[model samples]
Target chain A: MLAQGLTITISVLIASAFFGYLFAFIAGLCRLSKNVILRKFTGFYVEIFRGTSLIVQLFWLYYAVPMLFGIELGSNWWVGVIAIALNYGAYMSEIVRGSILAVAKGQTEAATALNMSRFQRMRLVIFPQAVRMMLPEFGNYLIQMLKATSLVSLIGMHDILYYGDILRSSNLSQAPTVYLLVLVFYFILALPLIFLTRKMEDISKKGVASQ
Target chain B: MIEPIVTFNDVHKSFGDVKVLKGIDLDIKPAEKVAIIGPSGSGKTTIIRMLMTLEQPTSGDIIVDGKNLWKMEKKGSMVDANEKHLRNVRGDIGMVFQHFNLFPHMTILENCMTAPIHVKNEDKSTAKQRSIEMLEKVGLGDKLDNYPSQLSGGQKQRVAMARALVMRPKVMLFDEVTSALDPELVGEVLEVIRDIAKEGEMAMILVTHEMDFALDVADKVLFLDEGVIAEQGTASEVIEHSTNERLQSFLHRFRS
Candidate 1:
């Protein structure tokens, strides 16, 4: 009776982080790549995902992708992970690309003059600087990403919002009361992220100031 | 006299249809100090940029330390040299830009150490010691751990010089090295440049707008006008009192 909305909310947050980061890594590399086709495809993918509604993407992945492929991805937990990741990753790639470019060109030249290859330059100089620049943006994206997880309930993913929906239909609680508790549950799931983002912002601000 | 440490012969460069550098020939003996002074858009910076390999030339060879730098074919032709060859040649030539181009994310010490570690593949302790010696020479030893933004413009440029010098390059190409400094800050940076000039083993080519520093410290001076050498002589003849009308007009502008 007391299952409440806790399990559903935890599952969504965990699912988003694990998958969202993978997409961000792949998409970020794709966006930064020299291959014209890879760059354009990643650019197009980001645009398509960012241009359309998140709910549509989720529905397409869950309902359309499996049917198109003629495979059973419905019961797959990994599918939920991939869906959330690709959706948020499109936005995160942009953040990563901008941050990497924001690092001064001189550092790369210095590295080149020192005989470091492009790959080594990116890993040692450019990427580290980009990470520092992108941390604030990443934290912001993480919070938004966490909130976006609630949309999974529509796909019948057993998310916190779905739990609340079931509670609302049950007689143990009044409809209005059950609906109210779900809102509180979302706030519970989302508030910590907001606070965490704010904390990250403060720390990075100090880092920039000290520099 | 045995062989010029650097040679630029019939060099040509163009940006689109706009020719920035016309046919050019120059030579620098080992340990020679040469300064190039010119009007704005006369391509003083471009010459240094080409030497630094920041921009490739449209045609011609740039031989430095007695090798065809603009090309790599054994039979004498331009090269689409691999990154490895480019890096090797670049390692021998160090450049100080007009705007101090220090990496903002790193400490002043790390800024100097980056090449010694990443490029030279020196061990951490050895590179650290060498970089510290360089930072001390440029007077940034106290601010080793501070990032570039925390330092003044002048300090960052000093760190830039230290970073360049740590590699112990055979040739140092300076592109208006102190132009970005505040009037008051220019002297310290120039003093460091003069100090490098004193060492006298490295071939130094300085492009500068500071007429006095060019005349005072440059062994040879070239007055460039509209992408060609308008006049050339020892610093005293070309800069102090030249017969060329174009040179006189240029000096008058600086003097008066």
Candidate 2:
């Protein structure tokens, strides 16, 4: 049962993290777009997701949204994934926007003098350097998003925390041991993310260094 | 008489209320090397910047190769140039900046290759060969794989020159290119520019403070003061025998 619970947890984490990053880059670039309507719409999306609680979002999507709209989502799991992705993506997009802005203005000027089109300038010169700046902060958000996946159990997804709860309710005497194992499970899951972050940080250092 | 390659007709520019350029007229013949000498805020840098399209003229016209630079024909009438139009007209011009704004992530070779391959749509193998040739000419032949951070200021400036040269612009503008270098390192960058001026058929406009270097290479020299050409003549005629009081004082300060 615990193994099955871990599978569900990993599945949700992977799916949400993928969509989260997709939303992040799109919303982030849109935030800097010259089009006013696009900039305002993405700004609104970011504010709405960031302004609310993730747990509230998950609950609303899973329960309240279905009743209010009188429609059935394909699966309860999707609701959890969408909530986590939207919430975490909004937070990460700020890091994206700030890092892109932080790249030296001279880089843009140099690209312009080379006769690169505006799209080519951003894609080849600006975004490559901006990605290096975004990596470390993005690593932090990835790990945080992993921990937030534990909240998905409340929406009837059988994550590790759900299994732990079941074990505790069945044997009250084993409650402390059960929760202790859950903590260990979370730490173990976070270990690889920590390692990846260190690797990304090393690469960013080489890209950013100057003599 | 050969047609002039570039002409500026009564151009004016102002940043808010401060006028940087006022009623400027200039002309350059093909392969002519012109040096502009002036004090700060004399609008010397602004002249080349307007040519490079880095800044726009507040009024009047810049003609490059007989085409208006800041205006395009739309519906048989001249309208303010758009990005596409500016880029098409600007393709004939190249500039070397004072700060050597090399892209930090790309190696020196990649810096030279990027614009040719991406902008001009040259194939990779040909671009690589041309980039290597240009890098060799600039004396960075072996440093092709090195990033900008690994290079000294002089070497970085040379790479900047190579990057501009690979495009083979009809007119090259050097905006105080060596002003950011250490005094000891200035000689190497200037030496490369001198060699380029000797070999390339491109018209060159150099805005510089080095009077000796100005006289060494420039065919004509202009002393700009108070947003106008105070004096213009051959290098020796203006640099050595000028009778303008303000230019004499300006050269006096430089001498000391």
Candidate 3:
């Protein structure tokens, strides 16, 4: 059971970061577009995902998208993965947009004076700055998505939470220790991300200082 | 005059209802250093911004080497040139702002090489060598690996100048490049600009607040007032003995 839970956790991490980053990149680009119509189009999608609860989004993906589309979404654990990525991708889009905007205007102007086209400017100049700006928030989201995997267990996915519950039912005496272990397990994953956030902030400060 | 490297013909520009440049007719001779100076809100900076193509004119045109830039292609009233053509036009010129807009993510060397590699299509070795030579000329070869934030304001501005110079533009526009620097740091950036201007083969347009420097270095001085050139002459006439009372009163502030 412990092994099964560990494997699932690893899969969750892979699925979320991979697809979350993919959709997030697209959504981020859409948001930064100059065309007001395109920006509004992306804005609507982002609001629907971000403003709603992630759990509800996950539930919709797991139970509803298939029914609405009339296609079979087989239960191969990919449902949890796709659901997490789409949900988190929307939330990550704002972080990406804000960071891209936060980059200094002069940088874009410099690229302009160099005669780089808009695509070249964003690809070479703006996106690099945006990625750096998004790193801390992305790390935070990764940890949050990890914690969110616990919810998938309630839907019959065999995650760590499921193992904890099983252990609790089989040996009631170990409930306190088992729950403490779960807490410690989450903290172990989350605490490193917090450390990484501090490290990045420190690096940025030092980078400025060195400049 | 080398056939009017740049010309502004009755160029009128405004932001919404607030007009910035009203009928700014001017011609920049190749390799001439002209300084534009005025009280705040006098539209001195707008002239340079218009030349840099940062702002578009609401009416009239800017002709660069005989090319009318403001005239976009029209097929039954559909504008075709758009931002892409403007980028190509901008390549023939360079600008340095009050804030040294260096690429913070890149090293100083990369900042200098970006245009040469991407725009000019120069080889990596040529770009690297030129960037090094430019940086060394600006006394920044030692700081090539440093980011803009790691450098002093003066150092960053010098890097900015180097970045523009590396492209070997036909014209360079400076909008108060030293205005944002410390009083002490101002000299270093100015000294570099003076050296470039003195080379006497580069067309340079300057918008500056330093009256003394303008008088010393500028071949001609333009005094702008209320979106028009109130008075303009050789360095002596405008800076030394302005007959205009408003210019005189404006100059009085410098005395204190």
Candidate 4:
């Protein structure tokens, strides 16, 4: 039961993070783009996701959305993935936009003077430096997204907390043992993520230092 | 007679109500070195910036290499140059800033190679070879692999000069290139500029506070005051023999 729950949690975490990063980058670029329509659309998306509660968003996606649209959204799994991704992605988009803007204006001017096209300037010159600034904040968002995945259990997805609740109910007399074991499992999962963030921070710092 | 490489036709620039440049007309022949000198905010730097298309004129035109820089042919009409048109013409011009704006993430070699490779579509090998040659010319060949953070201000400025030169720009604009450097370190960067001035056929416009160096290196000097050229002549004539009261007072402020 624990293994199945861990599998579900890890899968949702990885999938949401992947999709969320893509969404954040696209939303961030749209926010920065000169096109008014794209800017407004992405701005709306960000505000809608970020302004609402994550649980409300999850419940809406899982229940209200399908009913309103009269369309089946495959499974609770898909709903969980989309909800967590869109919620976290909206928050992360601000981080992405801020980091990109934080890259020195002089860098852009230098690239412009060199006659680098806008694409070349962003890809080769600006983004590399901006990525360095984004990584630490992104790591924090990753952890936040991990914790937010627990909300998926409310939507009837069999994530770790859902199974932990089940274990608590079945063995009410020995509930402490079950809850403690569940806590250990979560700590075990979180340890590597925290470690990975640190490792990435070190690598990026070293890259800058070596350069 | 050889055509002038750069022409400013009654150029006027203003920022809101603040007028910066007023009815300026100038022509720069190929291989000519013109030094612009004035007190701060006299619009010395603005002239170089306008020529580089970093700033646009409020009225009139800047023509470089027989093409109008501020206006571009679109369909049948002349329109303000867009980013594409600006990029198209920007290749002929290069600028070195007071602050050496080297891409800090890149090595000195990469800094020199980036523009040529991306803008000119030169292959990596040829770009690398030319970057090495340019870096060597700037006396930074040994520091090619070093980042801008690792270089001194003088070295970084030299690398910047080399980076600009690697593109073989038809016109070079130096905006107080040594003003940010240590007084002791100014000579090395100026030495590199002097060498380029002697060797290249590029038209050079220098906005410098280094009056002696300007007089030494520039073929012509323009003394700007209150957004107009108060005095203009040969380097020695303007620097040494100017009778214009505004220029005399401006020069007096710098001399002692």
The best candidate in terms of lDDT: 2
Per-residue lDDT tens digits for candidate 4, residues A28-121, read 9999999999999999999999999999999898779878999867898889899989988999999889888877776777787788898999
Write candidate 2's Cα lDDT for A119-152 as tens digits: 8988888888889988887887889988999998
Error of 1 at A119 (Å): 2.3
- Compared with the true structure, what per-residue lDDT tens digits does model 3 show for residues A1-211? 5556877876887788789988888898898887899899888989888889878877887778888998756773777887788889998988887878877777788788777788888887888877877877887888888887787886788878789999999999999999888777777867887898877766544322111
Interface RMSD of 4: 2.6
Give the CAPRI class of candidate 4: medium
Q: Summarize candidate 4's per-residue lDDT along B1-256 as a digit string, tens digits.
A: 8899999999999999999999899989999999999989999888988877778899988999989898999899999999888888888999999888888889999999999998999999999999999999888889989989888999999999999999999999999999999989999999999999998688899999988988999999998888998889899999999888888888888899
Candidates in order, TM-scores: namely 0.92, 0.96, 0.95, 0.95
Shift of residue B85 alpha carbon in model 2, Å: 0.9
TM-score of the A chain in candidate 1: the value is 0.86
Docking class for candidate 1: acceptable
Q: List the residue pairs that clash in candidate 2.
A: none
Segments of candidate 2 deviating more than 4 angstroms = A208-211
| lDDT tens digits, residue span B1-256, model 1 | 3698788888888999999899778998888889999889998888877777777888878888776766777557556666666666777788887777676667889888877887788999999999999999998889999988898888988998898899988888888878788889999999999998998899889988888898878899998888898888899999877899988887889889
The Cα error of candidate 3 at residue A130, in Å, is 1.3
DockQ of predicted model 1: 0.45
lDDT of 1 at B238: 91
CAPRI docking class of candidate 2: medium
Interface RMSD of 1: 3.3
